[model samples]
Target: MTGSGTRRLGLSRVGAALARGWRAVSWYVKELVGENDYERYVTHLRRHHPETRPMSRREFERAKLDRMDTDPQARCC
Candidate 1:
């Protein structure tokens, strides 16, 4: 029981980290990809796997704007 609980805890931490990484990737995609390709990528990730999380272009853009506002040098445009 203790071992299984520990495994579950570890999995939760991994899941949280993956979520954060996916957020960064989504932001990068928003900055780099064309609209159609960005939508396609989001849809592909949503359709394909349980490990990857789906993030909308809008969400990514909003997050990107937020980050840019927070970091003086992050705004490229």
Candidate 2:
């Protein structure tokens, strides 16, 4: 291949790598922010306890808050 073609190929590979890295970072950020928790919880409930109903988002958040309030170890300044 010519010099320009080699440079283009290198740039294409770099762009793909950057895109993959961005996607990974975005997923991590979503998980870190608890954005995926509700979906995961729902999936878990459906898989493990299908007979029981899953909590609504509001109920889930309220229950989580209540638990945090009751647990001293869960507090952070």
lDDT of each: 0.77, 0.91
lDDT at residue 11 of model 1 (Cα atoms): 97
lDDT by residue (1-77, candidate 2, tens digit) is 89999999999999999999999999999987777888999999999999999999999888878988899687563
Q: Which candidate gets the maximum lDDT versus the true structure?
A: 2
Model 1 lDDT-worst window of ten: 30-39
**Clashing residue pairs in candidate 1, if any?**
none
Q: Largest TM-score belongs to which candidate?
A: 2
TM-score of 1: 0.40
lDDT of 1 by residue, 1-77 (tens): 49999999999999999999999988888767544555677777877875887667788767767877999796556
